[model samples]
Target: MISTRDLTGLPDVSSLRRLLQSLAMLDAILSPDWQYRYYSFNCHWAFGEEWGSMRNGSGDEFYALFNQHGCFLKGFAHEALMTPCRDNPPKLWPGLFSNVPPEFSECLNEPAFDIASTTFCIWRYHDGREWQLDDLKFPAGSDPDGSGDLLSILDGTPETYYVWAEEYYQEAWNDTSGLTRDAVAAVYRHQPLSNELVSAINSNLRLEDLADDLRDIGYPNQKKPA
Candidate 1:
């Protein structure tokens, strides 16, 4: 239930590049720690035309997207067994519901999907109330807006969500060691992680190490020259 409005204080995109650069430096410093290998420093995928992704030696993966519209982040516990579908989208909604909370089910209406069967669980937050989408805006051929989930209409920027995704992937890695394709797919289907779980995962990460590395890399205290 953590909404984008709650993360309004996070740094904006202008600072994101410097932050990512610092993360890369931290990744290099933490190379000996197997748990930290999945940490990524590159945000180029945030600006790519299509979904861009990165994988660690352990096979865990993170995906990101950014454009004129907004941004998005997706992480898989491990490489998915299924190939990216170019034609028929997989029907995965029915399978996903069994794992999610009942309130989330209340948010369900007419769900949408991509060719790869990635479901778009759209919801609206306005007037301090959440509303579910009864209809979807499926992407027409070559329509940029149609490409991803219906997030552009949401209230806040994607920066906070991006940070949450990074934390989520790190948690997934920490909670499980050898994730199968089925387990990874299950996470994709049940996209949102619990706030309690997020907090626990965040607590376990050695983010201070990254902060120290950022200082060493000339981004002391997350500040960099223009």
Candidate 2:
């Protein structure tokens, strides 16, 4: 099973936040149609917290909350045996959520993320040395909790996102969709937002069109000052 130790690919908290923002921004640019996009980041999610989320429209989803205290995240992969269901009776796997900071109590049961059905959980304090896990005893397998499937996007790489987006959004992508490898890489690098960069992903989209999305992500809408 993919253990927390195996998650070395996850970037540091600050970088991960930027990566999530970039992913959301890229998805917004690629899919002007909200109904077709699978990712979202809301930096204004609450008074002092930002929420990063992904919902596949199927039964898989992950939610991450960020604030000065740091980040706390929970994910649900319904197909995983560890996931809670009527049959599974909502019992999370051992140590899955045992050690999250009490200050983050609100995130433990947010209705939108469906905490009762969660399969994996992780957290990191703002000044901590590393991302903390609860030392889960995963079942014998390559991806018992489905972290391998869900956390790949958090691997801090543009190539992974590119390959996945090409297949996932291929049917919806058109000439005007304007996806290119370099464009994807640029966003992944958290490059400064620009009209040209926006157009590189979707000719039909412009910074003006992505105003709301950029706002929700708490990303700069205006170009960096020269």
Candidate 3:
């Protein structure tokens, strides 16, 4: 287990605030009354493989395996999934993958996986509708279950997340100078699955003035932690 003690000097108020905003976003994206599940996969050393097992999905299917892998590769896979598919209206593209293998494409072609990894929170939006991994769709013949394709990138815990998070923060800070942007973006970049919370915070918050508030709070530059 990574000791909180080791994480002490990293960014305090800004990062914590971002963390709170993230959780709050989770609440918003997923209505409070909605049934939700959380799991982690990838580098077990960092997030712990046990985290993924805690969720309700059956490991017997490809989407289930894909979602688990997606969570572990959240930093990349989720972002990829979020990118809109230009060719298919309403259907989203998974992201920029180099040479997507045939096996993975096969799984996607048949809609074998309905929910993308980040899309698992759909359960929150659909009451009485349980989120199952099998509901997700992959390109035909795609091996959405391929172990080597993604896990290869998430071998180190937090390293991938941190790199993604850091770049995310820098971009948010540069685009809009303020506390809220930094806080919100920090969480969004790491765990975008928490969409509800982000929407709530953003509903009343303005990216333009966040920095000023952070400055008033004695946090220099109204920026979120790097």
Candidate 4:
């Protein structure tokens, strides 16, 4: 598992943005219901920012912010020791956001991202020299800060998401959805969306069904895809 602290293993800001868009678009197609979807992206989130997120619907979630300065990703594994729920004042772990640069200071209090629930965070500047984490020690335990699984999907592997989607959304829908692994990979590659690809994943959905998601995620719409 790639933890947020394992910055070298994570993709750079641009790649990570594309990957997050793919994840959001895939979830939008596979999950017709907006509320139940595991991932989401909003291109028009702010004047100069885009937001990406994952919510398992059982309290675990991760959110990312992208803009001119760079990218910031924060995750909250609700069951971890660092969870805000464990404290009387609903406190965040010490030093979690201490090193955030001025470029991303706004993200620290972004209400839409649920800043208070954070357990772990990683960030990088637009120059992309390195992905940085805080200089704090975490509680002793395996994956205590919840960074392990939360940031692992950003490895930019389509198969990683495919295997996970199969198990995570399995049979929860009409049954034929989410079986098209190649199509999923195509989206991960930032290929233009197409009718065939949409139906392959979920026979019930058409290209038009994903129109809003494409717009929201800022994904390339496929008038024609080779």
Candidate 5:
């Protein structure tokens, strides 16, 4: 695992931002390939976070807590609390999950859905060692997208493993606390007033539809919510 720490506060944050900016300038001048430049820039940020938090020892080191969606918690390591998100794509966070290993393709059972470009693995914790997606996380969520098999997908994978990391990103976007019912209806265009679904939404319930909020956001899907 590529480990790093989270640096919070204005001074550290500003320093990190400036450093990233400088790296970007260097990349533009030195590297011809933008992909390689971006990759190098991400590595620098990841390592800088680690070096900034050197006070605590290794076991209690204040590492950066990155959610499956690439949203990072500042100055604290909280990997245990991250929830798995399979439906949303991982590539949403460009450099964070940009490179996936070729070994991942070996785990596919349904060869069709396991497209070479689209598929990727999120991080997971097992007994003691870190296992690959093919060896660990993919078995559960392997079937077609909406087979009502989400729970099953999680079952076979290491305790809380999911296919992609962006599920956490969707969670952040669906915040409805400040908005009124009318406001939410205008944004969603779906029935926001239905008592049951609204109640579920109010209770912070996570169903397939809410979890996979990206599904119908762009286009109409004929299939019902599973």
Candidate 6:
């Protein structure tokens, strides 16, 4: 469902690289317990060990990866069900898109709704163009159901992968909690934060709060309660 044409007209690859770097750093600051995994040309970061498992017992696992070629992927999966659903499935947390620029929003593909599975997004940039696929599926195993591209890109052993449930945020707070604007600016470099990202981080890093923040930014919050 995704094609290289989608990667047209995006900012240079350097910008995307910086955005991902900043996001990884911020995620580290917000969730200190997470482990960082690195490969030769790519890296993976996650909040829990059973991130890609169909039998994850943790609350929910969040995972993200970035490739040297400017491909960014991130997603979350709910604790697996004893019996998989047969109909309308759970949507993924859109908080990953919180900091994404508005211009890039137009590049997102329509979501492919399905039953219980890992929900994710993939963005690729090359030759000053960009392409995005959102709400894609990630089933257990190395087969290329839909996430084949993602799997192929991260072809390396992880340096460190922890198996545990980690809190994303310490507690609710009014300010950045000592995170200076200068620090954020340094990671972002030329990339600017979307209003959605600012609100999502401000709401104490709760997934629900991030969902609300997405709604406030005018994007459809499929994870939000009706």
Which candidate leads the pack in lDDT?
Answer: 4
Q: 1 or 5: which has the higher lDDT?
A: 1
Least accurate 10 contiguous residues by lDDT in model 5? 1-10
> Candidate 2 on 167-209: residue-level lDDT in tens?
7777545333657889888888777778998888777777888
lDDT of 5 at 97: 35
lDDT of 5 by residue, 144-175 (tens): 21212211211221212211111321243343
TM-score of each: 0.29, 0.90, 0.21, 0.94, 0.18, 0.33
Any idea what lDDT model 3 has? 0.29
lDDT scores for all predictions?
Answer: 0.33, 0.79, 0.29, 0.84, 0.25, 0.34
Deviation from native of the Cα of residue 155 in model 1, angstroms: 20
lDDT of 4 by residue, 157-202 (tens): 8898988888777745436574777988899988888888888777
Candidate 2, position 220, lDDT? 63
**Inter-residue clash pairs, candidate 4:** none
| CA RMSD, predictions in order | 15.0, 2.3, 16.4, 1.9, 20.9, 17.1
Which is the winner by TM-score between candidate 2 and candidate 5? 2
Quote the lDDT for 207 in model 4: 90
- What TM-score should be assigned to candidate 3? 0.21
Q: How close is candidate 2 to the true structure, as a TM-score?
A: 0.90
Q: Candidate 1's residue-wise lDDT over 1-226, tens digit each?
A: 1212232332343333333443343333324253554344443332332222344555334343333433233333222322233325534323323333343332233121122233322222222233233233333333222212222212233343334344544464343322233322222233223322223333334434444433333332312431
Give model 6's TM-score versus the native structure. Answer: 0.33
Residue 5 in model 2: shift from native, Å? 4.7
Using TM-score as the measure, name the better of candidate 1 and candidate 5: 1
Candidate 5 RMSD to the real structure: 20.9
lDDT of 4 at 217: 89
